[model samples]
Each structure stands twice: as C-alpha cells, then as structure tokens.
Target: MGGKQPVTIMTDQCSAMDKAIREVFPKSRHRLCTWHIGENAIVNIKGVMAKDGFKPRFDYVLKYTDTIAEFQHYWNSLMTDYNCKTHKWIERLYDLKEKWCPAYNKEWFSWGILSSQRSETTNHSISRRLHKTNGLCDFYKCFLDVIDEWRSKENKGDYNSSTGNRYYSCADNMLCFHARNVYTIAIYLIFEQRFIKVIGLRCQRISYEFLVSEYIVGHPTKDFIRHVVKFNEQEMVVDFTCKSYGEIGILCSHILRVFIVHNVEEIPKQYIMKRWTKEAMNTIVEEGEDRDNEEYIGGVEGDGNVSNKYVRDETLLDVIEPSIDTVLPDVVEPIVEKVIPTMIQNPPKRKRKIKNGTEKANERNMRPKGIVEKKRNKLKGWNKRRERHVDNLREETQSTDKCMYHKFTCWWGFGSSNIFKFTIGSICSR
Candidate 1:
C-alpha cells in the first residue's frame, strides 16, 4: 500500500498475529473475525449451545447490540443466565470485545466486511484445485489459473454493468436517474435499496444556523433508534451519525430521506465515490499534469470550454452575470445559437427488429452447447439410473422377504443368493 498501513486489518484470533500487528502497525486497528469467534464458541461452549435458546441469544448479543452500554447489558445477562461467567474462552473474548464486537468497531471503515470469510472462501476455492503431492511449479500454475478465473469474472461483471438495463422503483426521481448513470450495476443496486427505504423514513429539521441544518431521521415505529443528519445548504454536503457513507462509500437511507425533504435533484459530486462508478477504470489525470492531448472532460469530448465542465449548472448563472458587462451584444447572440443547438441535440435511437417464431426456434437450435450443459445432462441420467436401481431393490425386498431371510441364514450354502439379499436389504434400508 505504498508504504502506508491499512486503516484496519481483520484476521482469525491468533496470539502471534495479534502481537505482530501491534508491533509492526501500531496505528492500525486490528480486528478479530466474527466467523472465527462463532466457530470457536462451538468448541469452547458446546454444553451451553446445546441448551435451548442459547444460540439465538448469543447471536443477538454478538450482532444486534449497537452501543457499548447495550452490549454490556446484554452480555452480562447472557453470562449470568448461561452460567458462563467464569468460562476461560468467554473471559478471553470479553477482554478483546473491542476487536470483534460490532458496537465497538462501528466508527472504523471496514467496507461493510465484518469478518475474513471472503479470504477464507478464496482459500477454499484454491485448496480444491491443489494436492498434497503437487510440485512447486504445479502450485504456481494452479495459482495463475485461479487469478485468470478471477479476472474473467471481473470482465464479465464489467460487461454486464455496461450493457444491462435495470428497472428503477423510483423512476420519476432525478436522484435515482443520476445514480443509475453514475454507478456500476452492483453499486447502483445497493444505492437503489437505500433509495427505496426513503419511503418509510421521516425527517424533521430540529435546528438551523447559518447554512447548516440538523435533522432527526427515523421510521415512524422506531423512535428510539433515530439517526441524526447534518446538512450544509451552501456546500450541499450531508453527514449522518451512522457514518455509513464513511464505512461503505454509500449514503445511508437516513441521509437520502433528508435529501428528499430538501428537494435535492441529484447526489452531490463529493458523495459519489469514483471507485463505485461505471467509469471507475477510466484514467484519472493528477493536478499539474499536462492535459493538452486529453479529449474528454466530465464525459464530454472535444469541448473548448474547460471551465464549464468543472462548474455546476446552478452556479453558471452567477458566472455569466459578471461576464455580461464585458461581452458585446453582437457576439453573444451568435455564441448562444452555436452552443444551444450542439448541447440539446439528442442521439438517434437504434431500431429494434422483432423476431418471428421460426427465426427464434432456428436461433435456439443453432446455439453452441457448452461443457456445463453436457455435464448437467450426464448428471441427470446418472440420477435416474440410481433411482431405478433403488426402486428395484425396494420392490424385490418387499416381495421376497422370506427367501432373503432363508438366504441370510444359509449364506455358506448359497453364496450368490446371500450377496444379492445383502445388497437388496442395504439399498432398501437406505
């Protein structure tokens, strides 16, 4: 990371790793994986887990508590009721609660990841392709294959994001339209979920000072868990107490509710993270870099007016008003006519050709089959044969129970019959 340590590092609970992180990256927050913690609980508290309602209560304490006070209250109650107050593993977990507890780690930016399960999943995939007897060269080759598969998946996602059309629940909202154009398909879906949640939320402004306003946002039924949103009217910036945007780079539902109340047309440019956008892979020029050869600015190509690309539409009136005094009336009319026509001209839409029934059937028949389809057909055939064999054995056992019983007692005298009877019994029982 360019010699800079990450803000947070998540790992399974290990004393050596904990010591190393504390020594090497003193400033970085070290987090314990919640999945590992839960897995450890199965081994450490098997007796407690066997009791009714213990698992659900444990899960609730681990995941649902949102404040330090709430966590402490529930944790103490759990320990008392479960009689695990003196349990060694539970005591150790309590000592490191800040590392694994959601309430304690909420302020940190983790990209919405609560555990290292994603890395574990990748490891599982790699392990399936590897062997204990594999050589170093074979291992390297397998690693490259895994990397290529990941890149292929990324390319497929990019293709879908670029070409796929998504249905918007709030089709009339300008903010939703702006999100659809700016964000990638996956990120847009996540944003849309938050946008849809705005319908259930209610926002009320509590204070106003200068250009800043503070609002309380929450659902009608949940008055106790309200979120505070602070909005700056001048800068068009919003801050939520949940810090969801800081952690995940996506605005929370509470902030969106505030925007709806204020009649905000589009998400502010500052809030729209470039990493989540469809143009995430586009080359970004740094400040003081040469831009003479650059053809595009703000998605517009070959535009001579560079200033307009950086300025917002609402601020254009202010800019043009000051320049009106210096501009000649004869020159202004021609400039307006030339720019207005080019700016408003819509691109021509492609005509769609409806396919007939025969044409569609032919296209389907001509489509090339892949290895996956062949494997699926082979699996289906195997399953059918197995089912038939089981049914035959079941019927034979039911019809010839007396003969099978005699064969079982006289196995030495009738070897083949004994083996057949054994097979029939096993299959029927299964």
Candidate 2:
C-alpha cells in the first residue's frame, strides 16, 4: 500500500505560505500548526495585552476551542467585548473559516496538528551546542558551513545550489573540532583540492601578517581568543590562526593581509572557499560552488559585524548599513533621522479654548502670556521669548546691572551715529 502515514512539518502559520501551498496541493490537506497559528493570531491577527490582563481571555479562547461550536461561541463573545468586528485580523480569519474550524475539515485537523512543545524542545537542545568560536572570521566560516550542511541534510541532497550543478556539503563535523580543527584541517588538507586550488595558497606570500592583526571592530565576548601571528624571525615564515564560528583554522593569511593593508586589487585565490565561491554557491557543495548570493545570510541575518564594511554580523549591524543602499529619502539623512526626536502635534490646540471666568485666572495673571514668564509658573509663557530691547543711554544713577548693549554709549549704537553725522556734514560742505 503506497501511502504516507504522515510526516509532521512545523512552520509559522503565515497566510501567504498557507495560501501558496493551498493552491498547489488541492487534494493534500494541511492542518494548521495550532501553536504557530495561535502565535500569529495573537501577534499579527489579534493582540494579547502587553500587560497580563489578556491572559485569562486568551487562555479561555485557546482551551475552549477544541470544537467548532465552542470556538464560535467564544469568538463571538470576544468579538463583541473587544470590538473585534472591525479588526482586520479577525475579519480575515472569519473569511478563511474553513482553515480554522476543525469540524469543517476533520480529516485534516486533529490533536497532532497543534505543536507547542516542539519549540521548547528545540530551544533546550540548542544549549548543548553553545559557547564556542575562537574569533570572528573563523566563526563565520564555520557558520556558513553549518548552514550549508544542515540545509543539505534537510533537503536530502548535497546542498542547495543556485547553479544547476551538484556540490557536496562541507562537513560541519569540523565545528566540533574548533580550536583543535587545525590538526583536523591538516587531515582534510590531504584532499589536495582544499588548499592547492588557489594561486595565493600556492605562492604563500599574501599578508599572513595583516589577517592576524584582529581588525574585527565589534564583538561582545571572546577576548582570550584573538588573531594569532607567529612571525618566523629566522625562516621568515608566518603562521596566522584566524577564528570564525568556534573554529581556528590555519589560514594562508598573507594574501588577505596584503589586500587589507596595501589595498591590493586582486583577491587571492587562497581565500576562495566553497562558501563564497561561485561554484560552491551554485552547488551548495564544499568544493567548486558559488555562494555569493548568500550575502543575505550575512547582511540581513543580523550577525554582529555591522561595523566592518567587508563583514556583516548582528552586533556589527552598522558595518553592513553602509554597504546596502538603505534608500532613505535624500532629504532625510539617517543621522538626522536618528537624532531628531519625533515632534508631536501640540495637543490639538485645545479646540474649546478656556472661556473667561472659568477659573481664578486673572488678566494680570495671563498678560499676553509673554513668551517668557516673570511669574515662576513651571509652564513657561511668551515672556520668556523677550530679549531686553537695549537703550543708547544708561538711566541716571546707572544701575550696576546694566544691559551690556546700553552700558556706556554702546559702541554698537554710537559707532553708527558717528558715521551718519560725518556723512551728513560732508554732504552739507559739498
């Protein structure tokens, strides 16, 4: 009997995806992953209160909705109380009633369809592989390797390649070796293609010194693990240990060093790996694949390399910010956008202006409400806006605290007067 008992696939209950799959698999039914469905319903569909007030109502809806009548009853009550009749998410859900009501499609919907524990299980398991990575570069390499390897395993293929060619997955078992991976890398180096395929690797003169300088701008932790450079004072050989994603592999750093420091135009071949190479990327393989399209992994993935122009990481989000055309309005610079506080409309101009005799407020109490206030009310009035209109001469018995503009025939006032008198006298003589 050729039949699939069923393979459970858990994904976020995104309507676009559900709709897309719905169009393709008309006969193949889908039960919404209830936990994700609930999450989406709460986050995108309905809002649970920010405070804990919404918990009982949310729990009531979740618990009582095992059957369609119960669900509808609770839903109607909720809709009435929250004014959810006008809510777009609730309207949309009702529009797609067939997907939500279990009784409407019992063959597809069941207790197995809902998954709340899977997420918790996955989170607990993630800690088993935590706290690793020697330096940033090595961590990124291992990071890419892990993704490719996992994707390949998930797809049951070598790796997902953009190009129509096949490439084997870079074995991420290397991540397990990490700081010990150099000895393991030497073992894989015997494969010959691993290091010998590039000219920079063959020549050995690319800047082993520079890549080991640790130009990594921003990383929160891992101060002990850094760029290691052992210069051969005698033989003139350099061994640079570079780290990325928990692995410290021996890199032919000379080329990367030269390119970084000297601003060399040609990227050395020694730096070419399946991760960024077109061949590696095209085939999702450890060898001969192109992976440039995977820039989204580094750019939007929110890794910390935002400070480095060449690197993108979550902690270093600004590093990638300059690289991407963050198309803000030409008039709206990001710096200005960040610094400028949002100006709110000044409380809608009090449409019903205060009528007279409403309070103990006196006309004397509110005299044009000078832009600045002589009175010490905290709400500054228009009186604050006034600057003293300075006069030319000081009052008799000149006050010690005289305005500087009128201190003693202010030069500003007298200088112009002298010029005016001279001009007038010259004109009369003429």
Candidate 3:
C-alpha cells in the first residue's frame, strides 16, 4: 500500500505468519482469527466441551465479556469449574489474550473483522476454478477473470449507492437524514439500524469532567447490563465502552441514545468514517502535481537506471509505429484484397461427374460410413421399432375395448343408463 502498513492484520494460527508480521510490520496490531482459535479449542478441549454448560460458558468468556477484569474472572471460573487450567491450548490462548480476545483488543480499529475468512473465502472461490492439471498461464487467466468479476461487483455497488433513493425509518430525525446523505447505501443501512435501536435504550448521566460527561445506557426492562458512553458536549465527540465505532466504524446504540439525550442533531465529522462514504474512492489531487505524470515518472524512474526521456520515446514509438514483421506478405495481401472479391462476385459451381452404370450401382449399394453415421442409423431404427410396437399395442387395446363394450352392452341392456356405466367401466378396465 505505497509504503504504508495496515492498521490491523488478522490471520489463522500460523507461527511463521505471526513472526513475519512482527518483524516486517512491528507497528501493526497483529491478531489471530477468532474462528481459528475456536476451532482449535474444539480439538484441544473436546472433553471440556462434552461437559454440560461448558460450551456456553466458554463462549461467554471468549466473546461476551465487556471488561478485562470480567473476562479474567469468568475465564478463571470456567477453568476452575472445568478443571482445564493445565490444558496447553488454554494456557497458550491466555498468553496471547490480547491477540484474539475482544475484551483486550477493543481499542484498536478492526472494522469488526474477527477472522481471516474473507481472504479464505476468496481463495476457496479461486481454487474452485483451478485444478492440479492447470498451468501457470491458465492460473493467471483465471486470476484475471476473478479480479474482473470483483471489479464489476464494486462498480455495481458504486452505481447503486449513487443512484438509489435513501430509505428513512424516521423522516424527521436530522441525524438519520445526515447519515443517509453522508454514508454509502450499505453503511447508511447499518447506521439506520443502530439509530432506530436508540429508541429502546435509556441513557442516564453518571459523571462529568470539564467537557466530557459519562452516561450509563441500557434497556429499561429487557436488559440488566448497561454500557458506558462518554460524550464531549463541546466537541460533540462520543465514545462508547463497547467501542463499536472503533471496531466497526459505526456508532453504537448506547452512544446514539446519549446523542439523543444531549440533543445532538448530526454525527460529528470524526465519527463518520471516510471509507464508508460515497466518495471513498475519490482522491483530492494537489494543485500542481498531476497523478498521471507522477505515475509515468515513477514507471520510468524504477531502479534509478532508466532515463525518463528515453522511456517516453520508446513508449511513443511502440504506440505510433508498427513492426515490419506484422505487415502481411504482398502476395497473400493481393489474394485477400483482389481474389476474394472476384470469387464472391462469380462463385464457382460444383460440377457433377458422369459415372458408369457399374459405378452408380456400387454407390447405391454402399452402406453409410463413419462411427457418427452408424450410431445415427442405429438410433433411427430403434425409434422406428418402438413406434411400430406402440402402434400395435394401441390397436390391440382398441380391439379389447370394443369387445368389452359389446359384452357390457349385451348384459346391461341397450338403452339403460346402467348399460352405459358398465360399458365405460369395462373400457377403463381394458
């Protein structure tokens, strides 16, 4: 990314990848995939999982804990209850608690991604189109096709975001309106969900510093647990204990409730992530620096060995001039330009050769050749036989029906309704 490191990197349990990330991008926050950790736990602590109430308790400790103290408390309780303190995998997970545990790593921005499943899914899709027999060239072509499909999807998303009409749950809410205007379609929908959820939450002021006030927000009757939200009235900055904004770039319902209580009409600029915005792909170019020119210079100045003027000249020559080898041979060109038109204007007629009587007889006696022709003839003969059999069966059925009708009519009497019914029944039986 042009000498820039990622803010956070998530990968499966791989020691080599962990070490490489630490060495190469020391500043980046490296996290293990929670999914991989869970899978490993299933393999490592199968006995613990088999015990009653262990799985839910383990999940609570892994994901639902709000604070580090709570996480530690519950984790220790779980270990003591399950007698898994001596487990090697559990010990290793505790050692790397900040890497995979959300309670410890909530401060860092991760865009709500807890696993490297996105990359894995893309790899799976590409692998579906590939085989062991595929060469490097075939792999490259498949890769290009996949990339083109991704670009097309991105373009479609962009079009939808730009052209689609905004949906409003509460048309009068300025915050919702502002969010709908600012964020792209997908992000706006997420924000709208959170915004709508604010109605269910109750916010109470807990404490206040110079400009920042903390509030405890939760449902009145439904939920017992409450979340803390710190709001700066002067700067219009809000921070939720859940760190929903940090984790997913979207304000939590607790924070939105706090905003409503504080009479905040619009989301603060800092909280509106640019990546979620409609103009995310648009870059503001500097007044004097042209991006195309810079790219050209960068291409020419690669390794500092090539001259820019020489590169430009070569590029121009390649575009403007055709190679001598690409020109068609003069003799062949004349046949295409001259002979093709003459042939089209005066098409040659196929001449029928006169044959002797013996030759004609031999031709007439000749059997159809080729594997395809023989198969076709065999299929045709089988179909004809089937049709003849069907016709014979239909004739036999008709004769049986006539005989049944005559017998029924004689037994039931000619003009009676019982006769008609018996005849119909006999025909059906036949």
Candidate 4:
C-alpha cells in the first residue's frame, strides 16, 4: 500500500520472523502476543504459578498498572515472594516485558488489541472454505467471498452509524444527543458507558490552579476504585490518572465525571479522536482542475471542528443513471437448453481372466469412500445468483403524497442544498 507500514505487530516469538520484521519494517514496533505468552507460561511453569498464587499477581502486573514504577515493584515482589527469580521461563519473560506489557507500552495506540487472538480468529473464519485439494480457481473464489463478507460487515456498520439513534441506559441529555449523532454505533456505546458511570460518581475539587479533582463512588462494587482527574481550565485540556485515553484513545469515566461537574455542555473538539469516529474512511471523488481526469481523495486529516470541501457536479448524474430518451436496438434472443439431473447408479462388475485361462473369479480392489470424505451440502444453494426481474423495480413517474424534499434535505448535518454529492457505490465494492 503506499509508503505506509504497520505501527506495531503482535505475533508469537520466532527468531526468523523477528529478523524479517526488523529488516522489512525497521521503524515498526514488534511485540509478543499476550495470548501466546500466557499459554507458554501455563504450559511451562503452571506448577510454580498455581502453587505460589502467581497467576493473578502476574496478570495484574501485566494489565492493571499503567506506570513503569508500579509494574517493576509488583513484578519484583512477585518473583521474590514466590521464589520464581531462578525460573528460566519467568526470567526470560521479564526481560521482554516492555514488548507486551500494558504498563510499558501505554503511549502507543494499539486500538485495544493486545494479542494475536484477532489474527487467529480471522484464520479460523476462512479455514472452513480452504482445503489441501482446492485448486487455484477455488482458492481465488474463497478469497473474494471472504473479502466480500468483510466489506458487507463494514457497510452494515456505516448504515447503523448513519441511521441509528444514540441510546443510553440512563438519561444524560448532553451526551445522548451529541455523542450518538457524532460517533459510530460501536464507539457511541463505549462513550455511553463512561457517561453513565459519570452519573454515579461524586466529584470534589482538590485544587483550583491545576483544576485537580477527585472522583469516588459510594457503592461497594469491585470497580468502585477512586480516580483522579486534572484539567487545565485555560487550555481546555483534561487528564485522567487511569490513562485510558492515552492508552486506548477513549475518554474514561473519571474525565467525563469532571466534565459533568464543570457543567460542560458538549465534548471538547480536541478529545474527539478521528481514528475512532464514523468518518474515519470517508472519501470523495473529485474532478481535477484540468477537467480531463478524475481522482479519488481520501479522508481529511483536519481538526474535528474543520469541515471538508467536496466537488458537486449534477451534470455528471447521467454517468450513473440511464437516459430516459435513450433508444435500444432490438435483436433475436438465443434459446438455451437446460441439462437434466442424473440419478446415481451402481457400477457394473468387471471379471478378471485367470492366468490359467479357466473361469475368472470376481474380486473388488478398491474400498468405498468414508463418510468424512463427503462434502457438506448445507451451503449448496446459498446466495446463488439469478436473473433479475427489471419490471418489478420499475416505478410510475407519478406522486400523490406531499414531498418532504425540504425536511429530508435539511435532516441532521446535511445542508438544505445538493452542494455535496456522493455516490454510495464504493461502499459495497471491495
């Protein structure tokens, strides 16, 4: 793709693969997969971990802390108390802590994916359509089908983001009205959870200059841990001690609680990260200045408050729609014959002649195939293509109901004009 490379790679430890990554993507950060690391731990040192109550402590060291000091203290304590300092596997994992531990890599945005489990899941998803006996054509078809399915899911996500309402379990009018309309469904849900938690949080001002605030909940729940928030009133910047936003690009409940305490009407523009928004992949097809060539421009990287410019040319509508006055040539159609289905039949027996030239004895050399060799018929007629009935899609050019052309055009953020023209054809294409 262009000159871009992966920001980070999460895979199992292998010397050859590590060397390849270093040579090809020298600037990319490579991390061991968390799942594989834990699996190896369980397989190699389960006795020590289970006997010394090390599993939960080690997991906490990996996931719970966000600072280097805390991670180091906890790790050293676990090793010393459990007598695991001499364990070869534990010592090896400790040396590579910065590669996979959350506390060490909190600054990089991994999109909340900490392991190679997602890669494994994708492999399993496409494994069913693959076989050792599959030909090249079959493999190509399988690849296209998998890609089409992925694009279909992405289109569904876009549709939900465009049409769905921002729903909250609790009544938070400010967030419900704004975040629902601004973010995609998946992202909106995450923000909604934080907003809901902000309702139960009680905030107290600790300092005025730094705008330091302490938030706590009265409930005895396991997640009722107190959080600290620091805000810069003049600069409109907020920081949470949990470091959720820094680590994953999503504002945590603590920051949202501070916002609600300060009576913030809307989310700050700088806090709305473009990578998590619904318009992350939005693009436009624009005409060049020479007016002879067309090019596709990718999504804008402007500030959240800034708007993108688009090219609108209604005269090009004919490129997509057929002209009403267009004349068609008439031709004779060819007749096609349908093939008849054949019935399964048993093979005729063959008799072999003896070497003595006497009566031949009948014998079978081949064994019948096993049931496991038979292919599944479940998907035989799935998503089959058929001839389209054009007449059913044709509508009469007459309108009886009052047209809400104005109401629909002005709906949401769309301007009450056709200045922005978009063709949705690219969404369904891979």
Candidate 5:
C-alpha cells in the first residue's frame, strides 16, 4: 500500500481489470476468484457439471491435487471422460489454471484465501449503508464510515496485542511460557494449538549428528500422512518438509513435536518471525522514528523510502506511541514521552462566538412570524382533508356491510345464512 506491492491480488475474471493489474502491478501475482469461476461454470455448463461425479471430480482436481503433474493428469482425464474437450469455458479455465489452481500456484503464499469471496463479503457490508441512487458525497461519506469501522477493529487488535496477556496451564510446562508473552493473542492460540497437538504425535529418530537430526513423525489421519522433520540442535532450527513456516509464517506440528522431543525450552530468535509477534507493528514504528529521534537514539540509518516498513503511517504510530512507551521495556522505551502529545496535538485553528440565551432568543425571533403560521395552517388543512377522506371511507364501508347482510338473508333464507353465521360464530367462540 505504501509503494510496496502486494504478494497477490485476487479478483473476478474481468479483462479490463486483468489488463490494468498487469500494467500497474506487474510484479504482483494476479489470481482469478475461484468462487466466481465456479459460479460461472455452474451457469454455463450446468448439464455437464450435474452429471454423476462430475462436480466432485472437478473440485478434487482443482483443490485436492497438490502437484502440477497430478493436477494435469486428473484434469485431462476428467475432460476426456466427460467429453468436455469442446467446452469453451473449460478450455479457458485450463489456459488460466495457474491463476486459480492451488497445485499450479503453490509458490505464492495466498494465506489460504483462494477466492475473492471475502472481498465480496466486505463489499456487501459496505454497500448495506449505500444505495445506487446515492450522490457522490453520500457514497464518499459511506466509504469513510466503512473504512473507520475497519480501522477501529485494527486499532482494537493493536491495543489487545500490546496490553493483553494470556496464560495457558501448558504455558508453564514447555516453551509455551515464552510464546505466550511473545506472540499476540490470536497467534499465541495458534502456536498453543501446535504445542497441544504435539502430544498426539509419535516421532522416531531416523538419523543423528552432532547438531543435526532427522525424524519421522506419525499422527492419526484418514490418509495417514507421515511428516519428516529436520532439526539443527546447535542453531535451534527446525524444518518440516511441509514448509508450513515458509508458506504460512507459522511452525508446523512436526517442528513443534521435534522441539518438544529435543527439550527446546524457548523458541530460537531466528525462528521467531517478528511478523507474528505482538510487537510486530510497534517494532516497525520504533524503527521508523523521526530523524531527530533516530539521531539521538543512535538507531539504524536508512533512506526514508526503505519500502518495507509495516506501520500504516506516522499517524497510527503517533496514536500508539504513548501507550507503547508505558508498556515496553525501559531500555527500548523513549525517555522523552511528554513531547509525543505536543507533537500529536495542534493549536486551535480559530475562535467562535459563544452567545448567551437572550441573544439566541433574539435570533430565533428574527424569523418571519408569517412563515410559522403558514406551516401550522398547512398541517391543519392536511389533517382536515385526511379526516374527511376517512369519514367517506366509513360511510362506504357501512353501506357495503348493509348490502351484504340484506342480500345474504334475502337470497338464502334463515336456514342457509343463519347456519353459515352460526358455524362462523362457533369457530370464533372456540
């Protein structure tokens, strides 16, 4: 957002959007929304997709296959089996497979967001307060409202990460004690889950060295997937063949199991990705302190356009610096706290006239009396017309009622009308 391109961008299949993205963000991987493509397939090839096993097989090829070879084989087999080789939609999808297929795009970290469905959901939320007929000003205000709501949630997350502490019973038992203090609440929960899951895993040492070891790990699963873990004891580094850390920025259960087996009491600093830690955002803010502060603190030097600083802007940092200074370690916290408020707040721009009650009363009296009386007369005349209209409706209703009663009695004698009336009365009485 700050001249730093996104790793990936997902949108529905629109040629214009695709062309624009290619020109504007050529480095960013552009992905078509899987949800949109699936919906388009349903609409365009409903008959083909509804055939026995067609839909499931298509989904399996798209989502389940993990390798390019497996994906291509399954996809080709499906096309041949269904005789869908002639389908234009299928042909187009095959051409663009890497944009939507998980197997083909495994190199990019999509964060498990395979579709634009979440963006669509956010669009619906923002649109709920908007309308097609809205003017530009109204739409702009609504957009700001939606942005404010999203920013408020981000601020809440920051506040919680900075001040909140979570203590699990297992925290005292293993490296979780250190993790609870280092990671944010949501991230700590994820790490704690891996720690808890490590209990169910059984690891067998496959090879050993002075500082490196390899292990085969087993867990209960439908497919019975065995995981391989390699560890460097001296460096306290662990690697799982699954590459969970590389892909998702979190250590896998296999690595956790290895760590527990090796009695690693704390996570290595190198393995502790700052992006997942509670102080991640604050760390960026501290790093990007003003030139004066950096000079005084002897902070690292870099051109202001370093491009990778993660804080939203200096404004967010200003809002958070006060509370952060109070909570962070004394060595890292700035000694000059009072200057932050002065830097954040600006002097009043202008003055306004504050009038007493008599002056306000005189202003109100300055309005023309005739206009007020005209409004009251207009309201009274409208009420009178409504009352007259109501009276006419009542008269018409009474006439219709009388006609119905007399006609029923005359046409069907006492037997038909009276019996029908009695039945209705009995039903109502119950």
Candidate 6:
C-alpha cells in the first residue's frame, strides 16, 4: 500500500488530510467532486436549473493556468444576476475561490473540491442511528452520534434516491419569504387544462393558522407565491388569478412537485371547497327556525314552502367550483406527458450484392456498414485464387512443368551415384 500510492486524488475540501497527502507525495492530479458543487449551488439558489447551471462555471474555475482571469469573469457574472442576498453564501463562495483561483495563491488546498456531498451524505447516514432515542435531549445525542456515521453508510451499502437531490429537504425553498415578512408554500394546479397557482401562507414560525392566495401564469411562481402568503388576512383568495390559452397547458414536474410538498391533509377546506362544494351542506335555514326536526315526517311537501327571497339568495351558493383534486389531474396530467418527440429519420438500409458490374455512389454509401469492406476483401481473394489456379494448370500441361510439385521426393546424389556404379560394373565385367 505504501509503494502503490495513488496518482490522483478525488476528495472534498479538507486542510489537514490534504497536508498529509502532500507530505507523502506532492505531485499528483487533484480534482474536486461534481456532486459537491451541486450541494453548494442548492444551498444558495434552492432550485433545479440554477443549481444545474453552476457546473460549467465551477469546471472553468478548475483549469491549471489562465484560470483565475477566466474564473473571475464567470464568478462576477454569477454574482451579478443571482437574486439572493450575498451575505449568507459569501463564505462558501469564497472557499471555492480559494481552492480554484491560482492568482489568489492559496496553498492550504492541493486541488479544487469536486464535492462535499459524499462527506455530508455519510454524516446523514450516521445520524439515522439515533432514531432509537426519544425526546429533545435525544436530538443532541443523535447529532453527536453521526460524526463517525459518514463511513458507516458505505460499509452497510443500500439504495437511497433523494439522499442526494435534496429537493425535499428543509432548505429547498427560497429564504426571501422571511425578508418579505411572510412564509409561503404554493401548489401549481391545473384545472380543465387551465393553469392555476395555489399558495398557502403562514404569518410567522409559531402560528398554526395559514392564509392563502392564488396567482396567474403571467407572474413568476416565486414572487406570486410570496404574495399569496403575505396577503392572506381574511377569506381565502380562491381562483384569484387566471391564465390565457397560451399559458394554459399540461403541468410540468415543477408544478406537480410543489403540490406534493404541501400534502392534501395540510390543505384547508376553504381553499378547494369551491370545487367540492355539496348541495346538502349548503342547504338553507332561516336564522329564527328550530335547528332540530324528527326524521319521521311522511310524504310531506310544501306544507309551508320557503319564500322567493331566500331562493334567490340561495342561488349565490349554486355556482359550484369543482374541487382541486379533480383539477389536479389536469395539473399533474392523468397520463404522463407520453408524447415523446420523434424525428422522421430514414433508417439505414441493407446493401444488395453487386452481381457483376461496378457499384453506384448510392450503393457505396448504402453498404451495410461493417459487412461491406469484409465482403469486398473476400471477393478480391476469390479472384486472386482463380487466377493462380488457371496459371498452374497451364504450366502443368506445357514443357515448363519443372515447377510442378510431385508428391514423391528422390535424392539426386543417390540416383547419380547408382548410375555411375552400374556403368563401372558393366565395364569391369566386359
């Protein structure tokens, strides 16, 4: 293990561990983790696209030379358009600058931090062990129990999906709600193929009550969702906003995802009562009437019918707004968006064998990829064999058959010696 040291290091930002690594072998490629950048991005921006958009900028920061100038340009652009306040994430952002920017000339880090996600993930696994304990003091004990738990998860080994995405985590929403003097959670709803954004709001942390508002498609979900929470002082603002046909369509995962965040249980009845409103519940009685009646009344109708004034007043309640759950399918789509985009590409065709003549340009291109060259080389070999076979036959019939290879082998030295000996014997006998 000592002799077989690693040539590359892929790890999170750790000062002492990095120092130990350099002392052991100073020359090695050190790259930051990809998943760690995503964690940092989500901590700042708190959504999918902005988090995804950070990768290229972080990568540009990691180049060896001329990287500082390039990274400074990207860093400035990122800081410029970012909607969030700079105070909270300023330290985290600067940590990246220290690690990646060569001109900053910091030696505490040998390489860029690829990601801190793995280390944090390990920590999360450790904390789960404290689930056995009960009560507030157990929380502190559980928190302390996770320091070694990071590596324990990898040792046990199991599957966890949202374990990394952090979309459902407590930090997944915008912090601007606090600054705006309100807190909100909105459901992006689609009803009858129309877009309706539903938002629920709470005044402060400890309050059990929530005020809610609905917003139109023209507004961004973030700002309008904020308006819903902050403005809810009295009655629920149901169907407060509308969308044009262009804005109306199938709901994306983003909208559906928010509905899932705020479960149907937590949703107030006033919010969706317009949709699920029942005739029996809305039945009218005069303010002065006795509230209780025997159920045994037989075949009775209009002994004394209610007045026209009450009937006309009851008509206001007749306008039934369909419940949100019915519309939510329209929002989430009863069927997934299965209309996969397809291009009418002509498939590659099989090549017909050229029986005799030369091939055309179309035939050349249409040659069935790997087989074309293979068949061609085979045909060339067949022709070479045929030519040699014909020449061999011609040479065998002519006097120049010296090149003919007989199956038998005779030693010329032995044959000539026997001939000479026969001649000498004949001469001596004579």
Off by over 4 Å in 2: 1-10, 23-26, 41-54, 100-105, 116-120, 123-127, 130-430
The digit string of per-residue lDDT tens for model 6 on 1-430 reads: 4355554565555667678777876775444454555555556656523554443444443432222333454445445445433655555656656543443432223222345555677667656565655677887666666644644653322112111111221232332211111111111111211111223222121122465422211122111111111123354222211111112222222332233333322233333322122222234543444533322222224675545655665675565444655677887653445332222244444455566865444354453333223433554576469546543432322212131222011111223224223221211222
- State, as a TM-score between 0 and 1, how close model 5 is to the true structure: 0.58
lDDT, model 5: 0.66
| Residues 142-196, model 1: lDDT tens digits | 9999999999988877876776655555679998889988887777766776787
The most accurate candidate by TM-score is 3
| Native-referenced Cα lDDT, model 6 | 0.36
Which regions of candidate 3 fall more than 4 Å away from where they truly are? Answer: 208-211, 221-224, 284-430
* Ranking 2 against 6 by lDDT, winner: 2
* lDDT (10s digit) by residue, model 2, range 1-430: 1333422233455668778666655555555555655667667744544433344454444432333543454456556556557877767767765554443443342333445466666555443444564567765665666668667664432132221222112333232122122222222222222223222221122223443422221111211111323443333333433322112122333323423334333322342333323343334334433565355345543565433534434447766678566555554686576655443423223223256736432234333432112121331232123211111111111121223222222211333224223221211222
RMSD of each: 22.4, 35.9, 26.2, 23.7, 25.8, 38.0
Q: Estimate each model's TM-score.
A: 0.62, 0.26, 0.65, 0.62, 0.58, 0.22
| Cα lDDT, all candidates | 0.71, 0.38, 0.71, 0.59, 0.66, 0.36
- Tens digits of per-residue lDDT, candidate 3, 152-243, equal 98887687777765545577988888887888776776677677778878776767889899876766543323566788899887767677
- Weakest 10 consecutive residues of candidate 5 by summed lDDT: 421-430
For candidate 2, give the lDDT. 0.38
Model 5 per-residue lDDT at 394: 33
Clashing pairs in 3: none
